[model samples]
Target: MATTLFFLLFFTPFLYSAAAPNHNAPQDLVRSSCINASYPSLCLRTLSSYSGPTGTPRDLAQAAVKVGLARARKASTYLKTSVTGKSERERAALSDCVEQMAESVDELSKTLSELKHLRGETFEFQMSNARTWVSAALTYEDTCVDGFEGVDRKVKGDVKKKITNVAMVTSNALYMIRRLDESGGLNR
Candidate 1:
């Protein structure tokens, strides 16, 4: 009886610990959610930094927008003041790109603030607006890229890389927000 008791006690924790490692639990939520995204890898990589066991789809979406905002802001700043040695047309295009990127940053900021005002039935409506704004931000970034065309190839390449990264992350944020609607993030 004592030996049996010893075995039970010794194996109980081991059994429990063995059962605790659920591979599906850690990333299943994020992976499944990101599966619908255009850039699933980028979505996962950008958002997994904010992942937690208890994080809901809403939280993930918010974190994505925050990351997008930071990237857009940094890109805007770089375009505004850093690049040099440009022709007249190149300088004009660079200036316009910086302005549009700043606008994109503003749109993302509005999205986060507006999320706090959503109601249950209207949650999708609010989310739609947010998604539209995000889309617009991407459009703005596209316009910025377009402006860079026919300019200095080197300068355009650098600025394009930065803006494009911001656009990709914003795209991920929009998809995450869409996932929120499916996950019942609208209601209290």
Candidate 2:
């Protein structure tokens, strides 16, 4: 009985370890990390699709900014190519929205760059900059949608839908950055 007990004790750990989920797996790390995001499911979707490291808050924040940047770029391209306003006002709004999307892309790129090099004594300052840039990116996205307010219903709907998706993603990125700041992950 003692031998059997010892064998169980020794093997049990191995069995459990083998069966347990890998917390360090990139997807799992992103999933847990995105739980506090404003749009958790969207955060999961965007960050999971990114083929990058996500082992730390900084890594996750960087990945998120990358995703947001890509989405903003796509939206900007789509606005430039696919959208056309039937009326002059609609055209103006579309123009303004396209510009805002471009600005969002630029801000997200800056945020990703900042997040990538966060270290040393400037870790907190770098994180703050990243958060601010991401926040600006989200703001640009929101402004893009706001420009569509007086547009034709169909145009407004279509533009709002597209910009709103980008905004949500950017907002999630901002949330991730904020969570990183609050986590004090930079200190470690």
Give stretches of model 1 more than 4 Å off: 18-26, 51-54
Q: Each model's RMSD to truth, in Å?
A: 2.8, 3.2
In terms of TM-score, how similar is model 2 to the real structure? Answer: 0.84
lDDT of prediction 1 = 0.82
TM for every model, in the order presented, reads 0.85, 0.84
Encode model 2's per-residue lDDT on 100-155: one tens digit a residue. Answer: 98888888988888777777788789887887888888888888888877678988
Clashing pairs in 1: none
Position 169, candidate 2: lDDT: 83
Q: lDDT per prediction?
A: 0.82, 0.82
Candidate 1 lands at a TM-score of 0.85
Instruction: Give the alpha carbon lDDT tens digit for every residue of 28-75 in model 1.
Output: 777777788878888888777654332567777777888899899989
